[model samples]
Target: MGPVPWTVNSEIYPEAYRGLCGGMSATVNWISNLIVAQSFLSIAEATGAGPAFMILVGVAVVAFIFVAVFVPETKGLSFEEVERIWQERPQRNRGVAAVPDQKEPLL
Candidate 1:
């Protein structure tokens, strides 16, 4: 996955929803992992794993295409600026804010 939306969303979203989003993201990741773990043997048996691997590759390709075409870059911009850009776009979904920069020295 890329860095843009993840960075943007974490910054701009309400604090309450941030944890929820994070939890959901983690859950989806774990679920996908579980699916892969449980199905790899079966997939290998059914289609020699080549087809299963190819399907994953295809899915990644499609996801990359969608992200490249639709997601905007957020690097080097403030969270608010990223939010403004997201809001201005008609086709884009809301993105998380960039994490705040710390100017004070660490204690």
Candidate 2:
């Protein structure tokens, strides 16, 4: 959690748009935090803590599934390599670690 967003933001964007994307990502992250913090107590009060937490858990599960399906494995890849992967791979193949005919170890 601590490093994941920063790492993904850095690796996912092209050099020309990295700053813009990073700023947007940070803005979204902070806004999301604000929303949850502001709503948690009210949600808990309306539906006990257990149900409130379960709602959060449900959201987290959906987020996990989205990432698993959409985010590419960027480990050991350079900025150019990462950009190339996104450009060359189809949407369905984006999440795969091993690209066809590529020797690069992507984990």
Candidate 3:
């Protein structure tokens, strides 16, 4: 859950910004890894493993909510289509970003 948003960030960014997003995603992953590696033992020591793990579980729940509420569905949409959806203002748009339900290219 901690890293899931970063993975989605890597996947959904438009091509022009994909490289920048990729670097950001990589940075997030590495930073997360470093934090967990450096702090897990201390966290476990300060609070028993049970508590530490529980904290993590709580974090996962929060992350899930954050993703669900804030992240747009991009699984089946093309980058160009997705970009259009996001670039247009909701007030001016009557529909959901013109996002399609396309599963795959017919070709």
The most accurate candidate by lDDT is 2
Q: How do the candidates rank by lDDT, highest first? A: 2, 3, 1
Q: What's the CA RMSD of model 2 in angstroms?
A: 9.3
By TM-score, is 1 or 2 better?
2
Winner on lDDT (1 vs 3) = 3
The alpha-carbon deviation from the true structure for residue 7 of candidate 2, after best TM-score superposition, in angstroms, is: 1.9
lDDT, each prediction: 0.68, 0.84, 0.77
Write candidate 2's Cα lDDT for 1-107 as tens digits.
33556878979888888899999888878887898999999999999999999999998888888888888999899899999887777665656757565688767
Candidate 1 weakest ten by summed lDDT? 90-99
Least well predicted 10-residue stretch by lDDT in candidate 2: 92-101
Model 1 C-alpha lDDT per residue in residues 11-91, reported as the tens digit of each score: 654455777877676666677778878987888788987898897788779978986887677668776776677567733
- Clashes in model 1: which pairs? 8-96, 8-97, 9-95, 9-96, 10-96, 11-97, 12-97
Q: In model 1, which regions exceed 4 Å deviation?
A: 1-16, 90-107
Instruction: Please give the range of 10 consecutive residues that has the lowest summed lDDT in model 3.
Output: 88-97
Q: Evaluate residue 75 in candidate 1 and report its C-alpha lDDT on the 0 to 100 scale.
A: 69
What's the CA error at residue 85 for candidate 3, in Å? 2.1
Better of 1 and 2 by lDDT: 2
Q: TM-score, each model?
A: 0.63, 0.79, 0.73
